[model samples]
Target: MLRACAAAFIVAAGAGAALAQSQPPITMAINQSPWLNSFVAMVDEYEKETGNKVELDVTPFGGLLEKIRNSVRGAQGAYDIVNVNSLWLSEIYSGGFLAPLGDVQAGYGLPEGVLTYGDTTNWDAEAGTFAGGGALMGVPVNGNVQVLYYNTDIYAKLGLQPPKTWDELLANAQAIQNEGEAYGFVPRAARDSIVYNFTPYLFSHDAAFFRIAGSGKADVVVNSPEALKALETYVKLATESGPPGPGNIAQGELIQLLATGKGAQAIAVIAAWGQLEDPNASRVVGKIDAALLPAGPAGTVASSAGHWVAGIPRNVPPEKQKAALAFLDWFAAKERQVDYVRAGGVPVRGDITGADLGDDAAFRFIGAYSQNAQHAVMGLPFAQAAEASDAMALSLNRAVIGEMTPAQALNQAAADLAGVLERNGFAVTKLPDL
Candidate 1:
């Protein structure tokens, strides 16, 4: 759409084998989000260089999954590329709707230092492993991972350093809340975000929802003692330090709290770091920064990974698939990625980590992005992921609303998930109580 940005990609061309003349115009269906500016700029660069039109049919995030599924069921998919959230990989991978990028990568090859993020890339339908098994379903276009976002100015005012353990974190939050200056924390608790946002607590407590035992088997542990403790701590954080009506707090509300300088700290996705630094949209510009999530008594730190991967539809024409790969190849190169980050894109390339981003507060979150990605865990990595995650979400919403105690909520969620797994023909085991 913009021709001026083409200069950024002028010299970042791929080899001849990756390109072809007279390629048809391709459309990619993606969701509307903050990082979209970077992707749009890159595509603009591609159109200028190859003289092939690529349309980005931006859609809402809520229904993009169903739209992509519907598109791929027909003889010719509606779009050449589809944006897939890492959470939905199990369903997408199981349906075989996406073309395996690894098959074609031997030709032009992935740029050196590009990461595959196995949860988004490799998959094995038969083994129930969404993490990896040789087939590359997609390339991560967004490197979204959760991190602890804290008000740096507030911390300095209170003589607080970033906490290193859950106890220390709670003490710091309580101290900030005591000052009555701002909310000590803000939690994301909407049905869609709850499971993901709850994962760090679950994992750092050394608890889990389920663990794949073997092919088609899952051992459910969502009601374990460790899980109960994690849930109790989560409730404490939200009710004691978060905004009123924590159950209604989603991404939009949480962002509003941080951007308006009403929140002191919260664990949220690193992608939203851009909004907190936007001078036009935020009152706290240059006041917020990120740090590693505090560890639990188990001595582990965990963050949920919400990265979105881009994949070519199996039903699109061969030329379009080839063209999509070509775009991805150029898009993921280290040179282009550097420019992408400078333009507000999340860093997906391994090489982007540790590079100096200077004093720009807008790009400062890149450091946290690198740190969180290392400890990130896929919350639900199974074909029943969507169904089971929704179960967790509903229970979480109830807990924040005071409708259910943390233990009751978790137990019900565990049982509900096991039932869903069984209905889906997966053998399930409830972990023994301590």
Candidate 2:
């Protein structure tokens, strides 16, 4: 009996030694965002619990793609783990930079349906798959979708109800302008951040930058009638109801405009909910609430998902890869995610399934936000997402600034997309007559 106990102790010690010896310090590449301070806040605790060192490099959103591009192209081992935006998954996975999550399934526990934004049948598609391909690439770490935020007092004073359609939204904007209160609406329109905000508008009009996946052949569809109409609506609204020079405004600036009451309403990202409701950070606190984005001519209110995900780089050593996956699993767990949200991080999980949000102003829209996430489209899932986005931005900016009409701008964008697709060896099945 004494010998048996001694044998068990030896086996346990051996396992511990194996773990300590194999895993190296993890280096994670993340986007620079204030909300992610929650991750930084918990690093010490994570290291203490795991007995592993972690190094975090937060790159600016504009520069992150280039930084990640260099890492993948060089296989430089610069990052063992990377926090990637949804649009970058296609390029990153195709570059062979990410290790399949399924390969490391034993390293983490997969959450059930109740904890994921989508159900079991679709969670894998939404959270795991890269570019609609059947490979699990990463675990979601953030929730970002567009929602409508309006100043309740302003709406009441203007006798405006929350907009339920784009026409109504336009009318509301017109009302604010005619009444001489403030900018009617605000949203990011700068080149660097335009695509993220523009996608919801594109979807609302049933226009897509590319038919990136599915049967037959993929194609660029940016010059369709729907796309032209959407572009016209966006440019007109910005010129008439939004602040002058919207082409220079981005997410942060738009948020400031709304929070300070310079804007009466906004179609903005969900990450700013905490700031919008905080009395210390906003002048409109207790006077603002969020609603689903207004529907388009098609009677659909589609949005694009902009969440960040944690993935392991394929260039890392096996042990370090294991450690990276372990970190992702721990960091994205239900308890940690909830704590992160409470600490100003964006909520990504559906774990609040049965928990009561109960009129807490900070949490009132979470359930609605989650529902929006399910219907959200992920943009232009192609190996050249960045390149395609740059092309679209140039044309979109021209239209917004009145340097070109919407039709001219969209025609140029469609041509650019066609060139990109053909250069990447994909056949363009269809294109607008332009």
> Tens digits of per-residue lDDT for model 1 on 1-434?
22224334344555532463456787888888888877777777767767777788777799888889899888989989888888777788888898888655554445566665535577876776775454777777888888999998999999999998888888888999999999998999877788888999999999888888888888999999999999888999999987899999999899999999899999988878877887999998888889989899968988888888888888987778988887776678776677788766887776665455556556767677777777778777887788888877888789988999998898888888899889998888996543
Q: CA lDDT of 101 in candidate 1?
A: 82
lDDT of 2 by residue, 1-434 (tens): 00001010001122223344335788888887876566665554455555667788878899888888777567457888787777776667666677777776553345542223222112223322233335666777777777888888889998899888888999999999888888988857898888777887888888888774443257678888898888888887788899989999988899999889999888787877878887898988888888788778978777767777777777778878888776666665565555555556676676553253335567666765766776677666666777888877888888888898989988888888788877877767556555
- The candidate scoring highest on TM-score is 1
- Compare the candidates by lDDT and give the number of the best one: 1
lDDT of 1 at 366: 69
Q: After superposing candidate 2, which stretches have Cα over 4 Å from the reference? A: 1-25, 45-53, 58-78, 106-110, 113-133, 213-217, 274-281, 351-360
Q: Please give the range of 10 consecutive residues that has the lowest summed lDDT in model 2.
A: 1-10
